[model samples]
Target: MTTTGTIRSATGYLRSWVEAQAAHRRVPGVQVAIRSGDELVLSAAVGVADATTGAPLSTGHLFRIASHSKTFTATAVLRLVEAGHMRLDDPIGQFVPELEDGGSPIARVTVRELLGHQSGVIRDGQDGDFWQLGRPFPDRSGVVAEVLRAGAVHRRNEHFKYSNVGYALLGLAIESVTGSTYAEHLQASVLEPLGLTRTGAEYDPARAEEYAAGHTGLLLGEDTRQTIEHVDTRAMAAATGFWSTAEDLTAYGAAHYLGDERLLSDDSKRIMQRLESIVTAYGTEVGRYGVGMALQTVGERQLVGHSGGYPGHITLTLIDPVDRLVVSVLTNAMDGPAEDLAVGLVKVIDVALTPRTEVPPPPAGAPPLASFTGRFASLWGVLDVAELGGRLVLIRPTLTDPLPGVEELEVVDASTLRVAAQPSFGPAGELVPVQRDADGRVVSLRFGGVTSRPVDEFRRLRSGMTHLA
Candidate 1:
C-alpha cells in the first residue's frame, strides 16, 4: 500500500532519518508525529523504550515531555481568561494568596507575566537537585515552599527569564480558582475537549507498563545507559510534569491553530502565539517567546512550538502556521538530539511538499541550456545547473542529502546572469559570470570570487575555454 500526498515521500525519508539519528545519538527510544490539518500524516518511532529491557519504542509510548506541559498549562489559563474566570493582568495574590500572606514578593506578579515568563520568578528553587535524579521532585506543599524560597530572580517584564516555579504557581492559582486540583481542571478543560486520551498531568501507575523508563549515562554510549527512576512531580506537574505520546502531543499542538475551535478561540490562539519576549532558551538562540511557546524563523517559514528537556527525555515540536503542519520529535534519553532532528525533519517535509518547478522539454533548437546544466566542481564543492519551468537555475548538490534549494538564473546573452529574487554575493543581488571556451563551449562559471569548472575535463578542449586558451 502506497501513501499519497505532499508528504507521502516525506514520511519514508523521515523514518530513515530518524533511524539514523537515533543510532548516531545513541538514544534508547524516539517517536515522531507529523500532522497536516486534522489528519495524522506520519507517526514513526525507533529504538527501544527501555534500553535495559530492550523494549521497542512506539508512537503510543508515553514520554515525559517536560516543559511542553507549560504550553498546556498556559492554554488552560487562557481558556479560563476567555471564560471570565481569570484575566491576564490579574495579580497572582488574588488567587493563590499563600505567597502574599506568606510574605513572598511573587504574589504581586501578574498572570500575564507568569504566562510569558516575565514574572521574574525563580526558575527552580535553590535545591534543584531534584533534576539530577538524586532527589525526588517536590510535592504540593514542598512546591509552595520552593516558591517561597524562589523569591524574585529579576524584575517583572524586565527580560525573558524562564520560571518553572512561576508555572507551578499558575497551577496553584488554577486550583484555587476552580476549587479543583490542577490535574482535574486541566483534564476537564483541555484534554477532554481536544479528545487527547493519551495525555495527563502526571504519570499513571496503572499505565506503568506503557511508561518508558528514563535513562542516563548515554555519554558512555548505549550499552552503559542505566534506567533512571521516575517520580511524581506532584505540584510541579503543571510546569514540567505532563507525560504524553507523540501522536497525542501533535494533536494537542494542532488545536492551537487559528481555525481550530475545539480548544481555543482564534483570538485566544493569537494571543498565545504572539511573540511576547525575546529569549535565549536551553542554549539555543530561540527568536522569541510567546505566551507559553517559542517562536523561530527557519528559512522563510515561521514556526511556533515548544521544546521539552526533562531528566531522561528531550523533545522538540514545531508547527508551520501557514501550511498547517505540526511535527514533533520525542526521545527517551538525556542526550537525545530532539531539537536538531525535529527542525531538520520539518525542513525535509517542507522540501518534500514544495512544488518542484515543471519545465517543458526545451524546444528543438532552443538555447541548449543543457550546456549550462550538468555538475560543476570547484574547491568549495559541487554545484549543478538545471532547467526548471523553462528557466535555467543554479543548484548545489550534496552526496548523501537532497538538494536544499535552487536559485533561478536569468540568462544575459548566454554568459552573464544575475540571481533572481535572492542575493548571492552582494546584499540585494550578484552576477554569476560564465566563461566559455574558444569554441563557445561552456568551461567555467564564477560567482562572488568563487569559480567552478566543468566536471568533464573534455569541456576544457572547447574553443573559447580559458586555462587552456
Candidate 2:
C-alpha cells in the first residue's frame, strides 16, 4: 500500500490520462464514478456529449447504457423472485408460453440459465438493422419466433454463451408473471422503488435534443473521411436500449454492494454474486460466471462486474466486494479508444481504494535476465518479445491503427505480460494479461472471458515463462 498523497496523485494522473485518451480516440463523451465504502470517491465527466454540436458532457448527461441494461433486467427478475412470484429454477416457458412453441422444449431452459447466459439461445440481436432501421421492433412473440426460426446454438446449460435474446426472454417472463409490460414492470418494481427517476427504456423523441447523439467508429478498410454512421436505436429497446447516467449507475452499484433489503434479500444478493460455473483455460478454472456478473480475482481480491457495448456506446461497472468500492465508466461513442480509457480509470480508482501501506520497491535484479522471451501466437493475434534494458519488451501487433508503434507492456508478474493498449482496456483494465509459460513461451492468453492457445503446445511451453513479471 501507499500513502494518501500517492493515491491522490495517482487518481489525478488517471483522470488526466483517461481524458487525453478519450480525446485522442475520438470518443464524444465519457463519465466515470468511483465509490469506496459508502462514499462517492470520484465522479466526473469529460469530452463532449455531442461532437457535432460541441456540447460539453456532464455527469448528468444521459447515455444509452446498452447491455448494461441487463443488470436492471436481472434486478427486476430478482425483485419478482423476492416476492415469491417465481423461482430461479422455474422453467421460463412456464411464464412465456410462446417460447415453447418451437420444437425445442422450453422446459429445458430455466430462469437461472437465462440469467447466467447458459440457455444456449442464439444472439439474434446482432441483426439490429432489421429492427433499428425503420423496421418495427419485435415484441416478445416476435423475438421468440426469431429464436425458434434461428434454432439454438447449443443445448440448454451446455456452456457459458452470452445471449441478449436470453435476457429479452427473461424480460418477457417478468411481464408474463407480473401481467405488465417489461418497461412497466421494471419501472414499478426497480426504478420507482429505488427513486431512480432518470432510468428507463423509453426513447422519447421529444427529449432527443437533450439526449447525447450516438456516434459509431469508422469501419476499417472503409472511407475514414466519412464518420461512422449514427442512428437512433429505438428498436433495441429491450436488448441494448436504456438511457442512464453515472450517478444512477453509482446508486445501482451501491444498492448491490451495500445490501439493499428493499430491492432484494441479502441471501439473494449473495446468490447473485456466487460463482455458478467454473470457466476454464486449458481445462483449468480461470474465471467464473454468476447470475449476471463476472467473478474474477486480481491478486487476492475478487471483483464482480460486467461490461456492455453497443454500436455507439460502451460501459463498464466493477465492484470490489471486500471494500464495497465500485468503479464505472460510460462513453457515448464506440470509437476504439473508449475501452482503454475506461480501463485506465479503473486502475486509478483501485489505487485510490487501496489503503496506504509500505511500498514495495520495483523488482530487484536486471529484470530477471529475460528468461522468458519469444514469439507467442493465439487466435487473439501475436506477441513478439525481446530483452530490452534487462527487461522483456513485448510487442502486440493487433492494436487498431492510429496508435503509436510498440506500446510498453506491463508485467503482471514474471510470466504474464499485459498490453494496456487501446480497444482492449476497460474500467478494470480487463483486457490485458497475455499469459506465457514457464519457459517464457506464450501458452495461453485471456481477454475478457475467451481464452485461446495452440493445440498441445502447453507441454512444450510449460517452463517457458516464470510467474508474472
Residue 366's lDDT in candidate 1: 42
Q: What is the per-residue lDDT of model 2 for residues 1-469, given as tens digits with 9 covering 90 to 100?
A: 3333333434443455456556545667788876655666567888887766677888887766777777777777887888899999998878767666655564468998988888888876536464334455566666777777774787888877777778878877877888877778878887887799667765556666656666666567432222233344333455666777777776777778745576778787787788887877678876677887777665345777767776567787777665576777887766535445544555434434442222222354424524445444554445445343323334342333212333334555654545444453431233345565565655665534544454346435545533453
Candidate 1, after superposition: displacement of residue 465 in Å? 37
Which runs of model 2 end up more than 4 angstroms from their true locations?
1-11, 125-136, 221-238, 278-288, 336-339, 353-469
Q: Weakest 10 consecutive residues, lDDT, candidate 1?
A: 353-362
TM-score quality measure for candidate 1: 0.76
> TM-scores for all candidates?
0.76, 0.69
Error of 1 at 248 (Å): 0.7
Cα lDDT of model 1 by residue, 55-133, tens digit? 7987789888999999999899998988899999999989887888899888899998998989888888888888886
Candidate 1 RMSD computed on C-alpha atoms after optimal superposition onto the true structure: 8.6
